[model samples]
Target: MAAFSRTASLLCKNAVRSESLGKLNNFCTSARGSKSYQLVVVGSGAGGAAIAARFSSKLGKGKVAIIEPSDAHYNQAMWTLVGGGIVKLEDTYRPMASIIPSTCDWIKDRATTFKPDTCTVSTQGGEEIKYEYLVVAVGLQLRYEDIKGLTEGLEMDPMLVSNYSAKYVTRTINAIDKFKGGQAVFTLPNTPIKCPGAPQKIMYLAESKWKKNGVKKSSTITYNTAMGVMLGAPKYAEVLRGVCEKRGIQVNFKTNLVEVNPEKKEAVFMKLETGETYVQPYDFMHVTPPMSTPTELKSSPLVNAGGFLTVDKYTLQHSQYPNVFGIGDCTDVPTPKTAAAVASQCGIVAENLAAVMKGGTLTRKYDGYTACPLVTSYNTCIMAEFAFEGVPMETFPIDQGKERQSMYWVKLHILPRVYNLMTKGWWSGPAPVRKIFHLGLSKQE
Candidate 1:
């Protein structure tokens, strides 16, 4: 009881000091009475939730606060299967209140602006959250409306689908089911998406579905991507290319989606090679929209020219502000954004952020590790795990870039379990599994 009072008093003193000394105009007056905290985490998704759990557990009551707008938390990772009609959308979401640890204060408001210099954040409801240290895990914002006619087409019948958000993922399955013949087009947007392989993954699932429905002979499938290769890394790309060839999946490289004329059932694409525009008629279109950093973060001084948080790629610490750090898709780190990557970085972030709070040098570092479980069909997947350097960093010793039933099983069954356990501060990365599998072999060999 006494400890709680002491913590509350400290928060009050800081809140008063922040308003008086900093003279932050953006802060809301109502929150001035609620007291300030030492650490404030913005967003409560994968990266935010995990780190919040770690920090709140370490800091105890009144020390940590999470600034989130959503009432529900979701696993964006599993949306691929949801789009494939393998899993229901309802299975992907949970109440945000139930997941965040009891030790932290939950501010159910969107951060309208960030004043990093003063360590103050203003909310939509006119509340001010003052903190000594800040963690930015706001994640990316999907820009579906950026594509011409995409918004209207997506909302209407004969819906052009997307798996990027909960609102639209169900459309992917609907489009696939309705396709009897003609072009079933799937696209990869030019922007950085959370799961780079997801666009093609759904295409494979649709192709498999077409075959199952006995429409394979009549239907034509196409995967148009802006990227030069099927994947970023060479090792995995080699395997993925083979899969495309074997599956008879049409691959169009450097082709980007620019517009959708749903009334005519036409999709317009820009060819990077010839600078030519082409319109193709489609029976079903699965669109992957452009993405960018959240509005508030992009406008702040914290983000770079690319509209992503400028953090040290290895340390997950802000380039300019030592007290501020970022993890997940929001950061300008040169790693593929995925929930698997967020999971691997959580321990490093938790340890390093704690060190920063205690006025200690950062002891832990986050390698640009990301894992993508490439679901090829309903019952098969290729688990591709790699780091920044492009050496295969698989947890299992066997070849990981190959399609396997076991990998599919893991993706459907084990991965979700690990996600639930890990988010609650239980599981770390697969470092132990890696060590156990490769006892004799050198990391390089």
Candidate 2:
């Protein structure tokens, strides 16, 4: 009890220093009191930045306000490469001020209370702001504590790591590079998470790494996932299954991580089918913990039963409240959460919200288009693009399901450029490129 109180005190103290926690704004009386904007964005992530940049420009200066409490904005997708030693951790971030538009007012504080019915919200920095329209882009929150002993396991050893957190990502590179032998385990948790394919991506990278270091035979690689199937998309799942078979990677479906014992180098898994438990000792472990929407958003009226924003999947507008919209991991979009998905949704939200602002009808529709550059090895990747029902939507002329060096290069090179363009509202998605590549054969789905 005393420790918990001390920890809370420390958090309060540090909140003043780090923007993500909270910062007391003593400079402006208006900032602390009631203020208003034409559009208020709840996060400064990919979706929020894109919307703010696009709408703030079109609506004019001071019309849009982004409520974010982070000093440094991260291209979180790059954390995968950082985990695999393909990129440096430092290279993945930029000053939040750089991406947020000068025309848009950034609140620089964490939102504490959301009152969607009244179109008002209270921030941790003591600001009560009202908005004509609200965009909820505050992404999923990681929950390592959901699994007992998981945090300590990550803290104790470099090999005991995860790509989920910025602090733990570098350890993945370290652990993989220094791996000697024995059971190297990777796990996908039972709950909904950001980047569904990332767990296996790292597994494949580790397998490739082991083969290169001549430790392939010495190490027994295993992938344990809670889902009964590997990939959510059927066509892509089939190819991924084949990849696992070809690489001799042992996969246990319907297996979920329940606990960890870092002292024994052991992880406990419960079989979802029969309610049986088992233990596996590991030399290296990468855990993708359960993730959920932020507690504040989850408890708010903005969210649905599952604690995701109840937005129309097509128009990206709130189901009950027409003035509210959602994007990124927070929305109940029914698509895998990825930067590509978020970028594509930005276009839909911007167009529809603009139409509504002008007393116009919402016409722009999102087709659930999403892309995942599944890196199969050091030099190969399957650039899987699809829509609502696992229907393959290839951007290039060739087969997207097949592993290709060209696709790997696209993941390694082209996507970063696209992400940068999207941040500045210059790129909504690869819609135009897709149309041109498909020779005007693009379907709605």
> Highest TM-score, which number?
2
Instruction: Assess the local accuracy of residue 229 in candidate 1 as a C-alpha lDDT between 0 and 100.
Output: 93
Off by over 4 Å in 1: 1-34, 440-445
Pick the lDDT winner.
Answer: 2
Question: For residues 1-445, what per-residue lDDT tens digits would candidate 2 score against the true structure?
Answer: 5764454435433433342211211111112227888789999989999999998899899888999999988888878888989988888888999999999999999999987534567999888887767899999999999999999878887779899987788889889989998999999998888888899998999899999889988989999999888878888899999999998899999999999999999999999999999999988899999999999899898888889999899999888766678999999988889999998899899889888777578899898888888988878999888888777777888988899999989988999888989999888778888888878886643
Error of 2 at 322 (Å): 0.5
The lDDT values for all models are 0.84, 0.85
At residue 182, what lDDT does model 1 achieve?
82
Question: Candidate 1's C-alpha lDDT?
Answer: 0.84
TM-score of each prediction: 0.91, 0.92
- Candidate 1 local Cα displacement, residue 286, angstroms: 0.6
